[model samples]
Target: MNTTTLTGLELRPLAVPADVSELETPAGHDFATMMDVRNRVYFEISGHHDESMSAAELLPHYQPNPDEIRFMWVAILDGEFVGRAGIDIPLEEGSKTAFWQIELLRKSWGKGVGSAAYELLENKAREHGRTVLQSWASHPAADGVEQIEPPTGFGSIPDDHAAHFYKRHGYSLEQVERNSAFDLRGSFEIVERLLAEATAAAEGYRVVQWEPPTAEEYVAGYAWMKSRMSTDAPSADLEFDEEVWDAERIARHDALWTDAHQFVLVTAAQHIATGELCAFNELVVGKDRAEASHQEDTLVLKEHRGHKLGMLVKCAGLVKWRELVPHSPRVLTYNAEENRPMLDINEAIGFTPIAYGGAWKKVLE
Candidate 1:
């Protein structure tokens, strides 16, 4: 299907190929162009390439998946690609949430391009039975720019172009997230000390580490922890469906990383007495070991809090990650500003705020 606006912008559905080898096809070529535009948007916002993914590494995810449906469209002006947008609808039973994103080159702003694209997105969401739409966008800092703070009172984002656009579209700034980075080449003395203290404090828990394609013994426990992420994490005024996870779900999650040739190190804290995985942390780096690593999904179960398991798993993971991907320059992570405990841990580990983002939401009438 094709959509056009008064601004002479055309929105065409993007086709996903079965594999990267299909790039020789017209659809594959369009997909590649979309990826290029995506990376450019990320770089322009974050001033770094860490968020960039190669076509080969990102293609597998665009293929069919059972858990959700993804639709993408490219923005064309005067027959040249300018940007793209997409919406992901989770297939969980009775879910009303649809996550979406819209991006256009700087030259395309204020031309009614974004408004026209959002019209199509909102219409699609309604067609899919989604009532709540949420999105997060980086609101990079700028001198003299006003800031919008979430009711949580933890972080604030500059009222930049994205903020104005979202507000005009009937979305409210619901939460703010902090983007942080840790220098890997810096000293690890503090990491070593924290690991020791946490290990000593976590009396009945032991640190366990492994790579993706989770081991057989830990799959169930891992699945339980994964499920808890939706509930356990600090989400201010935002809604997430309660996810059900199992061995099959774990496999699907692992393949998205392993199949992309990305290296993932899982550091988990296991209750030695019951052999239950109480807490975990994940460190990931793409095919290029020299680039920045990503810290993904660190959680210490609510029932197991106060044992310092959070610090134990995180520090242990970092120490191991350094040995495994020593060439990686640094590690990057994001957390809600209201999540004080996690932020404390990050700050103590020498991570500092590099940017802030706003989490916005709008409900359909």
Candidate 2:
């Protein structure tokens, strides 16, 4: 069925085809255009195409997932696709929080198109019984732009266009996340030195590494660590449901990366005696080996802190990642500004801050 598009300023749910190959069919037309606008919009904001992805690379995420229900829409202003919005509703029991995003070309701002699309998203969230809504947007540091700091008192982000919009819509800045990048082409002397220190500090743990489809003996431990990401990470006021993961969820997660033709490396810390996986770090690169690599999730369980596992896993991941994808120029990662421990590790590994993103939230009646 054709997606419902209203007049010139239409904001309608994107109708995706069963597969990316269906892009040739009318069914995939909206999906293709949305991906295009998404890419251009990001590049315009960051001046880097690191976040760009082909529709095929993003389709699996838009597909139905048992854990998160996705609602995506495209905005057409005067018969041209100019923007897109999405909401991901986590299926935890009694969930009242939904994470959403609204992206549009800079030229489309102040046209009321974003407001229209937001109404579409807010209405859907209310329909799903959601009470709290959260979203994030990169706020590039500008020389004269005012800045807003979260109550957590860690990092501050420019109160630029996105911040103004969020304030106008009743959302409060709860946290700021730092977007950091490590120069892979630079020397790894610091990384190797820190790895040795972390290794010595983590006396009872050893580094274990793998790709997708986690090994049989490590599935349970890996799944448990993955679940803790929802709670173990620092979030001052942003709401997140405690996710439960198992072998099936791991398989599904692995399949998403594999199907997208992306290479992923998982470096984890295992307890020497109990064989428990205490920490993990992930590095991912798209089909093009030369493109920027992404540092996905790096977590050290709360009970396992103070052992420098965070640094151990991170340095280990980067050390191996260079050998895995020798040509990838750089690695990018994000962490809450309040997460000083992780930020400290990244800084010691030669990561430099490139941008800051604001985490905003609003509550509905």
TM-score of every model?
0.98, 0.97
Candidate 2 lDDT by residue in tens digits, 239-275 = 9998999999999999888888989999999999999
Ten-residue segment with the worst summed lDDT in candidate 1?
1-10
Q: Report the Cα lDDT for residue 309, model 1.
A: 90
lDDT of 2 at 30: 95
Question: Looking at candidate 1, what is the lDDT of residue 140?
Answer: 90
Return model 2's CA RMSD, one decimal. 1.7
